[model samples]
Target: MSMVVTSPDFRWGLKFFKYLEIAKVNYFTNTTYLANFLSKSIMVVLRIWIFTQLYRVTYATANENEIGGLTVPMVIWGLMIAQSLNTATRPQLSKLIDEEVKSGVIAYSINRPYSYILFHYFGSMGRFVSNLISNLTLGFLAAFILVGPISLSWNGLLLGSLLLFFGYTLDFLIDLMIGLISFWVEDISAFNWIYSKSQLIFGGLILPLSLFPDYLRNIAELLPFSQLFYSGSRLIVNFDFQLFQKYLLIQMAWLVFFWLLVGYVFSKGIKHVSVNGG
Candidate 1:
């Protein structure tokens, strides 16, 4: 076969390395503007404090060591993970896609040799990690101050991290899908609102699914949104290998579903770009 350099699958190592360098650059870039993240960082601290206080009162009032097999400390720590994951990735990733579509800038990228989706993926990843680390630090520190130390095992941390990576990737795909909608709509703000609310209500970003009534928890767990936040967050505080495996399967299933969906949407969206003389 003739040499192939343009496609990612051709010399996958080099392509992956290139993507990683992009991530590294973004990570460092995010570290520079501390103030840019001030609002979110402050929210992380405040939410942790509020949740801890709220739950402490709840547990105390009820005189229960655990509600639905979850302790107050677990709630605090899980919310830290949930908030960090929720807030870490710039919500602007989808906005970037929206902007490109509105300005017809995406048309130029459409015909480029490399994949546009992958380009944005790697580009956002650097900043995503940066934001994630910063948020996690603030969250964990807040939790520690509020609740003292937590006991965690090495295996739990490692496995929980795997779930986190899976969740983040799935979440990014969700954002990408929302952004791609800009091709059809003049504005994607409504879509964004619906998505954020869904994450909150279904993803259990505020309340762990465990605390939900049995019927609701069952329904929520089946959604990709819960996997985006709750599954990994729950795994961090209450690491269960069996649940991890189940979460992995559910996430993988959604990943494949979204993967095909994104392809279909992008393919249709690109046609619109062509019609727009892009």
Candidate 2:
């Protein structure tokens, strides 16, 4: 008797392809997925329009050639990059976690072969990647038509892309940490609201951190929020080696801090979890 053998690489590739097929089927069958995609697409367009108007107004009043040591094109590029990052790492994962906790389905996940954190991370990453491509394409076109083409040095573009990925990872971890708190809290909506507002106010989503007041900017720089946008945008528009090193350090520190915090919370939450009548 002869037995067939399969290589591990082939097996894994087959599994991944199957997973994508299943996801495609799910996407088509699910109305909620369609609705979510539509909503996200509309919001991305709205944000690009609003930001473009603001950029135009500012450029019209001030010299189009001068603002924060950036030309109009550079400012527009920075805004587009920041918008892409925001769309990619928005805290949509929090609602999923909250629903699972509230429905007592988390216990089922806890018993799964895969770790809950890793499962959620990969799932959210897939969603983000899909959203990032869709949003970036729409946003870049809208921005280019409204604000013209923005130029970037080859090295700066490379560094900016790296920083954007780092920012995405850091932001996702932070969002997960916040969502994990729902395991203990009775209601997480308030926390979610506060977090969303904080990101807008402190994360430099709407405006560059350099444009903020001295004291406010200092506070933003000290926190992890600024690391999410400032590092990526600065590299795209300015490209300072020393500043990049400093921001990278801040991002790493926050990642380590949140990893430990989430671990501690998960341990405690798992121990004390009581399912209605369990």
Candidate 3:
């Protein structure tokens, strides 16, 4: 019998295998999924209880007067919207980047045809999609149970969805930029801690910017963090055309800035080579 042998496409096959391995590792060891579910559940429960207490207090104190131009329903909606829009990507991104650096696998990734930034982008998209589905479902359930069904017009719903998606993309890119700093820094734990805390405060996850003092509110509005939650929540409730345009423009500007920054950092990180002798 005659034998026939064909050479394999090693380069393409290797690349595909590498990506598959990464995906498998990420899927099986996704601790964030459990952590997110637990944390979000606690947050939703605590928030609902707090708001219910506030409503009782307000009813006892004043005879149906407006608090900061917000009725009880509006306040409830604002809280729900803000909580629902409290999306984040950095905690996982930082940990992934730090792991790569510590394990010395980043050197191999740097030598690959694909940019590390793009690799991280793919991994982050996986995580974000997972969280998006989980969080939105939980957020909707919490809103329904606590605030009841909200009546958003079709146009409002469409615009709010668009804004929310764009806001998420912008936030993801910003987190990637921060994660990339791991390439230069020895340890990123402190950076990650500070960044997460800042997000909690400035991203309007704790309280909507509407409740802030005027000066603090203005400062928060100018920062990119506000776009993460404040913009999307405001769109759902208020739907001001002019403000929407402004926030969208701001998101675009930050996207451009981070895109350039990531490019620059990747270029710099790739230039330094440290090959370990096997």
Candidate 4:
């Protein structure tokens, strides 16, 4: 038998797989994260349950099909999707970046073979993958059991899941930008706080933007945070292919913009590397 030969493309594919495998190992190897995942997941279940009941009480007379421009099931399901995305891709690594920057440990990263930012980005992706699996499994079960099934077809669920993957990229980029701000500012907590509140308000965490005053809703629709949770949640609950394409293209555009912005910031930030604290 002739010796086996691997093509360049095949070799590249193998390398890519290995990269993802390393990321997985990095994320899943942590024992504390597993505990935190379980605790937060339980809290999410209770939160969703309470919200569902509040809606039911408030809309006591409304039909199941519609409530404040959204169907009952849509609101419940939207909350699940929105919260799940938030839980899965909330950019925890940004804090690590900030800590590393503060302690000057980040300088060590320069000697590593891979780009520092890309390493963090992929690490975030690995966490996203693990969080997605855990949150979806536990959150969906809890919601279904407590609030009953929210109306969504299998196709819609599949489409929403696909879009969420793209959404994670947006989340990661935004967080990376915030984390990079540590390079300029002495305190990034202010920036983090601002971003968190902005995400909640503009991303439609408690209610859909459509229910907001027209001016505010229109503004929120234009904000990048909307693409993170609001768009994905709406797509899951409503299942509009045309709308999905629209939001997907919007996310892609924002992704490119942030990617370029991060590159620029990283270039400038590295130049000012004045490491303090060991």
Candidate order by TM-score, decreasing, is 1, 4, 2, 3
Model 4 pairs in collision: none
Residue 70 in model 2: lDDT: 67
State the lDDT of candidate 4 residue by residue for 103-130, as single tens digits. 8887877657666876776777777666
- The TM-score obtained by model 4 is 0.87
How much lDDT does each candidate structure score?
A: 0.84, 0.73, 0.67, 0.76
Given candidate 1, what's the lDDT at residue 184? 88
Kindly give the number of clashing pairs for every candidate: 0, 0, 0, 0
Q: Per-residue alpha-carbon lDDT of model 1 for 52-152, expressed as tens digits?
A: 98999988999998987688898899888888878887656788899888787887887876788888888888887778777888888899999887778
User: What's model 1's lDDT at 70?
Assistant: 80
Model 1 lDDT at residue 20: 80
Supply the TM-score for candidate 1.
Answer: 0.91
Q: Each prediction's TM-score against the native?
A: 0.91, 0.84, 0.77, 0.87
Alpha-carbon shift of residue 100 in model 1 (angstroms): 0.9
In angstroms, give how far residue 183 of model 4 lies from its true place.
Answer: 0.9
Worst 10 residues of 4 by lDDT: 1-10
Residue pairs with clashing backbones, model 3: none
**Every candidate's CA RMSD:** 2.7, 3.8, 5.8, 3.1
Error of 2 at 236 (Å): 2.2
Off by over 4 Å in 2: 1-35, 276-278
lDDT per residue (tens digit) for residues 189-228 in model 3: 7877786677778876656676678899888877888877
Better of 2 and 3 by lDDT: 2
Candidate 1 achieves a global lDDT of: 0.84
